[model samples]
Target: MNTAKSTLVACCQLAPKIGDLAYNRSLTERAIRSAALRGAQVVVLPELVQSGYLFADRNEALALAETRDGPTLRLWQALARELNLVVVGGFCEHLGGDDLANSAALIDAQGVRAVYRKAHLWDAEKEIFTAGSEAPPVIETVHGRIGMLICYDLEFPEWVRLPALAGADLLCAPVNWPDGPRPQTERPAEVLRVQANASVNRLFIAACDRYGHERGVGWVQGSVIVDADGYPVAGPAEQGGEQILLATLNLAEARNKRISERNDLHRDRRPHLYGMDSSLD
Candidate 1:
C-alpha cells in the first residue's frame, strides 16, 4: 500500500447504554459518519461499544456477544468501504458456544482486516471473558501500519511495545475506563499513561474511552489523540459527555523515532542488559 501523506484520526468517546445493542449500533454508526464528515480517515470507538460494559453476569455477557461476522461488524465493514476509511473499535466477541472474548476489530475498504483480543483482563472481566494468548499483529494500511489494544491491555508496557517493535505507526486503543478519584490536574491518570506510552514508543496513539454511567458504574471519560511526541493534539474530552477528538498526523514521523542525532528510540534499546535472558532456552 502506498503511504498516505497525512491522516486525520478521530477518537470517539461514547455513552453506550448497557445491553442496548441496537441503540449502541446506531450511536456508533452516527459517530463514524460524524468523524468521516470531518475528514477523518481513521476512526476509533470505545471498548465494549456495541454491548456496553458492566454486565450482570457471564450469561448476560454471552447474550450480548456476537460472532466475527455478526450484524454490528458487518455494518462497520460496509461503512468502511463506503466512506473509504479505517474503523477500529471494540465489542463482545462470541467464539462458538459459551466462549466469549473482549475483542477489537480493524476494518477498512477490504473488510475486516484484523481482530485483537484483550490479553489482559481487568477486574470482573476475567470472569466474563476469555483472555487472549497472542499479541496483536500490525496491519498495513494506506495511512500507516495500525495496531490495536483493548482497555486494560494498554496498561501493559510490553503489550504496547510489541506493536511498536513490529513497526506499527499508530496504536488504536479502545477503552472503557471506570470512574475514579482524579487529582486536581486536568488530565486523568489513564490519559497520562497513554501519553507516556506514545512518547516512549515514538508512535501516535488514539485512545477512545466511553463516558457516562452504565448500570450504576461511572466512567472517567479521558478520550484523547496524541501525536508521535506524545502531546495531546485533540483532547481529554469532557468527563461526562459524548465527544469526538480529531487530530491530523504525519504517520511517517513515527517511523523516524529519533530524539536527536545520537539517539534513536528503537536502536538505543538495551534489551540484552534488561535482566531477561533471551538465550535461556
Candidate 2:
C-alpha cells in the first residue's frame, strides 16, 4: 500500500449540455463519486463544467450564472466532505445584478476554499463575463498545497508562475479548449502548454477539458495530469471523448527545484529585467 505522500488525482472529461444546470449538477455528482471510488484524492472537472460553454448570448449566460452558494457548489462541498476528496471545478458565476464571471472553486472537506474568476477572457466571453482582477488562489489541504486557475489563463507563463512561487505543490486547471487545426500526427498545442507549465514551475498540473460540439464548436478534450518534469503521468485525453484521467503523484517531489544540481528554476528568474524601463508585469 502507498503512503500519504502520494495523491491520486483525476480529471473528468464530460460533455455538459448548455443551459442545463440540473443536468450538469447531476453529471458532476456522478463523476465525483466515480472518481472517489477509483481512489482519487484530488478530482478536477472542466471549466464551466457547471454551466457549459458557448452561451448564445449574455442573457443565456446570466441565466446560467450561479453564486458561490449555488446548488452546484453546494453539491460539490457535500461530495468533497463525504468522499473526503478535494474538488476543483469551474462555473459561470453570478456577480449580482447584471454582472457575471467565468470562475472556478476550490473545495475540500471544510467546504469552498477559494474562488478564482478567469482573469483573461476569451473570444465572446469578453461580452458575456467580467474578467477577474485577482491572482489564482493557493490553499493548503489534507492532501497537499493546491492551487487553481482556469483555461486560457494557462497561455500566460507569467501568471502560472505565481502559484509556483507561492509554494503550491499541485496546480489544478479547468479548461474548455475549442478544437482547432494542428499537425495530424502530432500532439495538441493545448496539452503541450500544460506540460511546459508543469516542467517550468517544477509543479504538478491537472487540466480537465470537456468534449462534444456545442453551437458548431468542438473541443480538444485534452484532460491531463503532468508531473514536475513536464511528462504526463496520466493523460493527454485529446479526442478521447467523455472520460476520466487519473494519476497518483508524490506531491512532495515538487519541492525540489534542482534540475542539474547547479541551476534552480525559480532562483534563476530575472523578472525585474523583463519589464520595459524596469516597470513590468
Candidate 3:
C-alpha cells in the first residue's frame, strides 16, 4: 500500500502466428517468465494472442475461441500463481450460445481477476466480434489500480477516460495492429494517438503489440511503455520483433498531476454533453 514505491511493468510484444494457439500460449508463458525474471510485477501481452487473427469468417473465428474460465484461462491462472505475477492480455472469447467477444483478461498472482470484452469494435471487428455492453473495469492488484484497454479501444479518448475517472493509475493495452502496408509517416500518427492518451490522462500506458508477419498481414512493430508523462521509456516506434520493454511507475505521482480543481478532466466532465456522443449507433 505504499504508493511512494515504484511499480515495475513489462510490455511483451510478439508476432503471434494466427491459428497457432499452442505456439502463442507457449510464447506468452515464456514472456511471462522472462518478465518475472527481470523483476516485473506485471506483464502485458497483445490482443487475440492465443489465436493469430484469422478474420476470414465468423465461424472460423468463433471456432478458435473459449470461455474465460476454460482450458486456456486455467493455464494462464496456473502460470500467474506459479510466477506470482500479474498479466493482462487479449483473447478471442466464446461467451456461449454461439456468441463471441474480442476480450481482454487481467490475471494476477492469484488468478484471472477481470475479463473485459472490447466495447467499441473497429473495422472488421464490428462484423466478427460482439461489442461488450459494460465499461472498462479498474482493477486493484498487487501492482496498482490498473485500467485495461485493447487495440482500437485506444483510438477513443473516452475509453481511457472512464478508467482514469474510476481511479486508475496505470493503463494496460494488448494490441494486434496490422501494418497498413503504408510508409512510416502513416504509422507515427497511430502511435502518437496512444501516447497522447497517456499524456493527457496523466496515466502510465503500457502497450504490447503483435509483430512479425501473420496471415499475409504485417504489423507496425513496437511494444511500448509510456510513463505518466506520456513518453516512451523503451521499445520500438516501428515494427517490434519478439521483445519486452520494462519500466517503473509511481502511481502516486500520476495521481498528483491531476489534483488541481480547475484542470481536473475527471471531475469537470459534463455528462449531459457526453450522452449525445454515447448515443451514436
20-136 per-residue lDDT for model 3 (tens digits)? 778888888888889999998888988898777757889888878989877667878988899888889888999888889999899987788999999888788888888998888
Stretches of candidate 3 above 4 Å error? 181-187, 259-262, 268-281
| Whole-model alpha-carbon lDDT for candidate 2 | 0.92
lDDT tens readout by residue for model 1, 1-281: 33458889999999898899999999999999999999999999999998999999999999999988999999999999999999999999998879999999999999999999999999999899999987877999989899999878888987888899899999999999987776766678898899999999999999999987777888888899899889999888847489888998888889988999999988887777876456421
Ranked by lDDT, top first: 2, 1, 3
Q: Judge candidate 3 against the unseen true structure and give its global Cα lDDT, from 0 to 1.
A: 0.81
Candidate 3 has which clashing residue pairs, if any? 18-52, 19-52, 221-238, 221-239, 221-240, 222-240
By lDDT, the best candidate is 2
Query: Model 2: clashing residue pairs?
Result: none
Model 1 clash tally, residue pairs: 0
Q: Candidate 1, after superposition: displacement of residue 65 in Å?
A: 0.4
Tell me how far the alpha carbon of residue 88 in candidate 3 is from the true structure, in angstroms, after superposition: 0.4
For model 1, name the residue pairs that clash: none
